[model samples]
Target chain A: MNSASPPDLLTRSGSGLLNWLHGWRAVFRFAGVAIVESLTPRTYNSATRSVVLKQIYFTAWQILPRFTLFAALLSYVLIQIVVDTARNFGLADYALEATIRLLVLEILPLMTALFVALRSGAATGTEVVLMNIHNEIQAIEAAGVDPNRFEFIPRVIGGAISVLALTAVTSSIALLIAYVVVYGPQYWNLPDFARVVAHIFDLPTLTILWAKVLAFGLAVTVIPITEALAAPKKLFFAPIAVLRGMVRLFFVLMLIEVLSLALKYI
Target chain B: MRLLEETPDAALISDSLPLRANLSVLENVAIVLQYRRNMNYDAAADRAWALLGRLGQTDSAFKRDPDLGSEQRFAAKLARALILPQPIILIERPGLLLPDTHYPAFLDAALTAVEDLFEQCWIVDYTWNEPLYAPR
Candidate 1:
């Protein structure tokens, strides 16, 4: 009760706000640096290409078959649920539209983002933090390597590609599963299914979907790496940085997904 | 013989090395430096001399001596000397040695050391059962 008075408290609160702003100023500045580097011709080196390839291999290539199956099964189950529910509510005509919107555009990207975020995001965060702590990045820079181009930007590119490839594979499988669930192995409905695909994945919708996936991937890899790099060499703060990165990544993924949904639906 | 109670404090002591950096500041700065160029050590030293003098090193031998006074002092000096622009994480603390009353001062000093050395800083801490890993 005898702490700083109201005016003092206001000053303290303003200081906290200023502190938060200062922390983000560094982040935004770094992000600007990343963007400028990304626009340059040297951004596409062999190392960068290899990092992108490795990210794709780990994210999309390795689990492609499993993710497809999982997406297919999940799509089938969800299509059935939506169809049955819609039919019970006497809106069976909306089954195909709802299923496509839900499975292909919504759940798949979010699931892929979460999956990648969990696997690679944590690793990237820890790796960046350790490198920061150990001064390895400094060593690299001292040796005349642009650590951002050589090490980081490539990861960002790789992550975006991985998200795109994974989403493509999963969405395709989900589409196939949706058809099977709705029409039950009948070739007669193939054209009808194609029409729905065409309708749902219209140009604008497709563009947004792809962009969102890319953004999701970027958020997962970039945010964590950035945050980890933000952490001090103190090992204890490493985990906290990671935690913050993950939370921010999760928030960004949700925001991207919701923004995409709002753009598509509303 | 009075046995020290094996509370968190005792556990903290047994694991001194792990907690050695417990109060240290950690930072990762991907980009830094007001200016960078290919320069010889002599010029770099000349540039860094004033900043080095301002540091509160008590030992005259350490202040003027070519050799670093300690591991921590050397790191702080090198970052200033080299002007290398890279992501840096620096941890500075008296470690888990001081009492809680003195921790704030220790923490401030450690952070100041790291902030002087690098742009990014993290304060590593320890709690019960936090995962500690050796770098591969």
Candidate 2:
């Protein structure tokens, strides 16, 4: 009942592949434009700055307290497990380094990316999809405002900065929690903790981490926007756009994490 | 609408050209000044306030699109369009945006209030609504 000619199936599959390639091409193209526009001095004006400030306030400053507490709790638990297990295995000397590497270099950054992606990235995608459906983007353009320069690029800038800020705050807190879990809440172990930190966070690792977090930040916002722009201008497409954006964001975040790990360790 | 689409200075106010839901009415109006003229936020807000004042809509400055009445929303849209430099105002089907009121009277009052700000004003509507714009 479902029989189809091989040539017809081949053509359909070929078109599907072309569509997939075109989708990715558009995403990268938009990302490049956003980056360029963000860097151009002419793009930063009163309106763009206002949008950037608002985006940072909503994305980073709003959820900061709750997110910090959650990160601290998770860090404490993970560091406790790592330290206790290492002590039980008669290798307590390496516990701090292991915990530092696992928590700071990997887990915390990835966690912050996921958190921002789920919260702000989804919201941005849905908003853009709705705006597209409403023809608001076209309207803005018709009013003599470049939507990319005034609206979208500013959000990308704010999102990247927010991810960096959140990652820095949470990672610093996690480091403090890691120290207390390892050395039992005293100043005597400060030198040892500093030594471990310095050892684990050499120049190359720091560079890789900073680059990775920035990449994650850009991906979270950029991917959603790109997908939402690609979506058909219809009300029912909003949810689908957000879903696709979130999935792509998650994949890209994981890829960045894996790549960073490979660069550092392998 | 199609005829004016290619005009470089035309500003179209229609159902399709809605206020950004995420922004306050003041922001929706001031953004044009901020982006096109590069005016700072305070100056843009002040100008937007002045424009809204002209329409007796200062009270609705901080409200969002969802909270706005039809007349207030139309005022905001009109103010936003007028903020453009020497704009050719194009109002497409005022009835759709102001369904519950006598849109002709509202449009007349609104345009008369800011007659000096725009270069010219145009209205596109269905033939059935011709009598609404006829001399009353």
Candidate 3:
């Protein structure tokens, strides 16, 4: 039905690679702007605040209960498996530490980021692409309104906060579930549990965990919006924008996880 | 639209009622003041209320955009655009906003408002054989 120029394979692949790199470059640049604007006290006026609040409501508040329940279910299952496996091998002492490190330090944050990325990040990309297609950004600019301050930055802040808040809640729930599964819901093991918690959550581990969570939070929203903006202002490019955003999100999530692990172990 | 890039004092009101549909009226106006004018929340709200009053849209301040009628929505968009101290405004598709019976009167009033606020305005209407809202 449609006839267009089909470039040679080399040119096509080369252009594709260049576009991918360009997308990442835009992401980092936008992330820089968001961080700077988010820090500036003047950027938090009524309009941007409203944007941020609406974003938080959709990304964090609306999905809180369902996400927590799901995280608890997963946590319980994982804790049971880790505890059972350790006991089977006569390694019960290491079970609690492993669970704490695995669930609290690594898995919870990654899972939270991935979940938010799939829901809110993808939605944000779609919204941004739609807005671009409709020339809303240019319209806002024509009105002397900075789209970054009013639109993109708020979404980024909301996404990051949402990821952070969800990670905290899910990780806490996972800890509770892990304790119950391992220690049989008894108060006598509180001291023991606290000791393991303190040991596994030492200064370096805690610092890395915090850094990783923050990175994940930033990536989930930032990458998608950047990808959306990189899309051509045609309706057909909307799905492609979302697809690229999601792929980048998944890659960044895994990369953060790997880097954290490498820093901790390697 | 060409004048906009050179001057920060330019405004645009679109046919789509470009204000965020999810936000309340006060929020829609207040956000522009805060982001563009660097006003605090309370100050932005105060300025927004005053602007809404100036446009005779005080009653629609808190209502959501989805609840507003076409004319009221136009008024809201105009109010947001006018929040900045812009000296030029470019209204896109002024004729498309209202019915044939209402558009002429609406354009008259809008032209009056723009004349009072801005030195120049470009009302883009493809149907007009002559400039309806020319520099007057």
Candidate 4:
């Protein structure tokens, strides 16, 4: 066997880098299409409507009770820890602001996305892969159906909606819990709590929060479907597709969190 | 109708797999009419039911893929194909399902039933005397 020369090694590394970039480009392309198609009113007929309903049912409705309870418990624990630590350190004055910033601005949205991604993202990715392997997508195309409109777009919309709804529910509960934990559920601290919340969630912070949550929602579902679509049409490749999707999803979530934090603090 | 392209305008009914296994029969058919024919939900469902009724598939109309038998699935897929208002309809390996003896009679009856909405129905099967055959 002949070893590669310097030029050959450089060429091989260059091609590998190009292939990696091309892979990411395809993911973004699919995401753009999903977003554009989802916004089109023509995409939502009875068929896709049913799909969207089913997706929401699976992604949001089924897990609402347990997921909210878990989030509330987690929020309570984090708030208690932060408040107690701040009081001990003689920084109690900043406890409310810090708690809100931690839970509302950061943790809750990412948690909701991760929850939905683990449950629904994996399922959607596997389903798409199986459909691809069995040529169901091809069959849909043969039937003159736009799979993007009927299949992927609705699922993406459903996933995004699910993320947003869950995030709202959990974040609201966390805010309530934060109040109770700090102000002892008394009505006397309403103005104080409101001022802190309003200050922490000012216009720019609110905008960033919404943008970050939407980004998380879109990434959780869109990345999985994109990965599944990119996978080779084989049964063995399905698991690999999901694994890659989940890993990419985690990276994306962390990246969003980091960027949001940088925007807010740095 | 370019059969070799990645996204074809024509509907394909494959003998080897359910057309869309994740969807119910009605959804599978309605998706075709809704997306391809650009009809609304009610209109697409109405047309889907009418087509299913015409094909004697009203029984399996609402059933999911796994619940339907081989013949019911085939009929559902055929309904999906016929729902498209395309000029050329491609039927692959008709010999696998529509044996030569039943090919002409089946095509004639179905074509007549639909009032010849399609101009050409290309049935591809290697066993046929020719590589490609079109019903007149």
Candidate 5:
């Protein structure tokens, strides 16, 4: 039977607070573990490379074509709207800059996070939680296998690369789309496109975007694994662990975006 | 008897305990592994998964990697999946809040696929459960 009603505000807020705290604590802790684990030689073994590559291959490579198309369409639509609206307002000079900012700095990576979250985040969370609940991670450890290097860090690395790779591909294509829409299909705007990339992606913006995408990807994998570990060793909390992971992932993605925007503009 | 004899469907979560936290995943099992009748964590976990069937519990998580699966299909996939089964099979809750964005579908499909394997599957813990325990 369903509760047929939501929890009272006090309970809802209390649990929300707890979940928020616990979720972040897990993230920081996972990060610390990853860093320490990374310092060790075994964590970077051949197995780790293979695992990381495979993770990137599946999570990033398989979806490359589809993600690029989706990003292209979204970028086209957005640039058209921005360019048209900017012209209507007689600020056509700012149109390209605005489109790049919107598409490159803001939209694409976040969309990638959402895509990974939908595709891999859930799976990672479920897998980790199951592993935690099952004791698989420990088994690896007991067998002289550093699970972090062998299993987890590869995931983190893969996720970061996926975000970067996807961003690179989509941002590149969208810039082309933006120019085609703005100046028609001609070489005249190549200089302008390069200028925008140079201007909008100045050293600071480039650094921030790179950092933000990395952070976003790390959060996507780290948060879920942390929450999965936090799940009680009972059958009921698996979904809850994943749920917490997804919510925390979204929050972290938003936070990364805001922080990057702040670093760039503010 | 026949139904009870089937393999139990159980989930298993594996993680290193935060160093700051008193209960590393291994330490959390200190009670069962070290003190209990002289079984190590691996042995204890194996024992636990086996006991689940008798408890009428089909799929539960053990702190061991039983036949592990991945988030998605990939190259060399067969090689990794062929690795050892998790040592402990603990029972955990269904992953709702963790990190699965493809919730209703990925999990739903998985659970539905494993339905015939277990007699009964229930989620009762942090992040473990089983949906594929063989029927008796």
Candidate 6:
């Protein structure tokens, strides 16, 4: 009974598209500001340092033990599967390379990013949304504090560092597990494993991996916070803000992963 | 209130300006000094502890916002505001922040406790609450 005319429907579609573009533009702008503020030497005072340390402790250190165990188990199982499949096809020589490419270069970083995004990203988003609703951001500003410098950028830095830390730990363990799985824990296969590692982890590959993981880390925290800041200052919008943040973050993470793969192989 | 807003050193204590829920009461109070004065964590914590001590809120130092009593939450907000250098304390609508308590008397006692820390103290409330501030 209330169907819109063609012109009205066109206008509504145009408006929705414009709003979508505006949201993306806001996210990029906020990310740029956070990056610039984080780089400024003056941002590393005692206050922000404390915030960053607490963030890292919560994001990486607190979950390190349990997450590492989980990742190790997963890596071993995956490596075994890859190795078995390769050996069945008389391609055992390519097993290590495939495992390294799959696990170390791609899977571990993505896993770590997802973990941080789910745990710390959601928490940061909810906290920020609540702060916005309660006018705490305004309060901090009124007290002569730059919430960007004092509150937000520190979290971005900490989250990025946490991602890198988790990725590094898990990736290293995965590599070790790959070796033990492929080479039976023998010291005699050390030189062969080193050769495969060096061949796989060339400068470009390493650089791309680092860039991708860093992008993942930044996206995890930055997307949530940007979305949270853009959310309406209403109690009901808190969950919506986090949901949008998480969805956007997942998209960005996948995009980065695809781009990295394209750069390395395509 | 407009005059207080015009000043750069004004520190507001209101229900709208809630303490950070993720942070403990001590962290909430100490963070002001840490951010503004660049005080180290230990020093800021010590100073915040002293401020909370002045309000007999040391027992609630490590508690977070949700865990705090109304009086303790108000004390944390007050301490956070008072930490500013030569702060002009702006206490807005005490009843909104401490609904169950006699806020006028509590504000009087709390302000009297930290009277020397602030340059001036202003209480902004609705006309309906005017008689509550009148001298008995």
Every model: Cα RMSD to truth: 15.5, 1.9, 3.5, 3.4, 14.9, 2.2
Give per-candidate clash totals: 21, 0, 1, 4, 95, 0
TM-score of 1: 0.63
What CA RMSD would candidate 6 show?
Answer: 2.2
Could you tell me how far off, in angstroms, the CA of residue B131 lies in candidate 3 after the best superposition? 6.9
Question: Which pairs clash (backbone N, Cα, C closer than 3 Å) in model 3?
Answer: A47-B31
Provide the TM-score of chain A alone for each candidate, in the order shown.
0.90, 0.97, 0.93, 0.95, 0.88, 0.98
Which runs of model 2 end up more than 4 angstroms from their true locations? B85-87, B127-136
- lDDT tens string, model 1, A79-164? 89998999899998788889989988889889988988998888878878877776666544543446787668877777777888
Please state the error at residue A67 of candidate 4 in Å.
Answer: 0.7
Residues B1-136 of candidate 5 have per-residue lDDT tens digits of 1121242222232122111121222222332333323445466445444433323222323222222122221101111211223322232333432244443344344445434434444433432344323222
**Candidate 5 accuracy as TM-score:** 0.62
Task: Quote the positional error of residue A8 for candidate 2 in Å.
Answer: 2.0
> Could you arrange the candidates by DockQ from highest to lowest?
2, 6, 3, 4, 5, 1
Candidate 4, which segments miss by more than 4 Å at Cα?
Answer: A1-11, B1-12, B16-18, B37-43, B84-88, B98-120, B127-136
Per-residue alpha-carbon lDDT of candidate 3 for residues B66-101, written as tens digits (9 for 90 to 100) = 688777777788877777666777777766765443
DockQ of 5: 0.03
Evaluated at residue A85, the lDDT of candidate 4 is: 100
- Against the reference, the lDDT scores of all candidates come to 0.62, 0.89, 0.82, 0.81, 0.63, 0.89
* Every model's DockQ: 0.02, 0.79, 0.48, 0.47, 0.03, 0.64
The lDDT, on a scale of 0 to 1, for candidate 6 is: 0.89
Local error of candidate 1 at residue A225 (angstroms): 1.6
The sequence of per-residue lDDT tens digits that candidate 4 reaches over residues A114-186 is: 8888999989999998998888887776555677777898999999999999999999999999999998968
The positional error of residue A171 in candidate 1, measured at the CA in angstroms, is 0.4
DockQ score of candidate 3? 0.48
Candidate 6 chain B: minimum summed lDDT over ten consecutive residues — where? Answer: B1-10
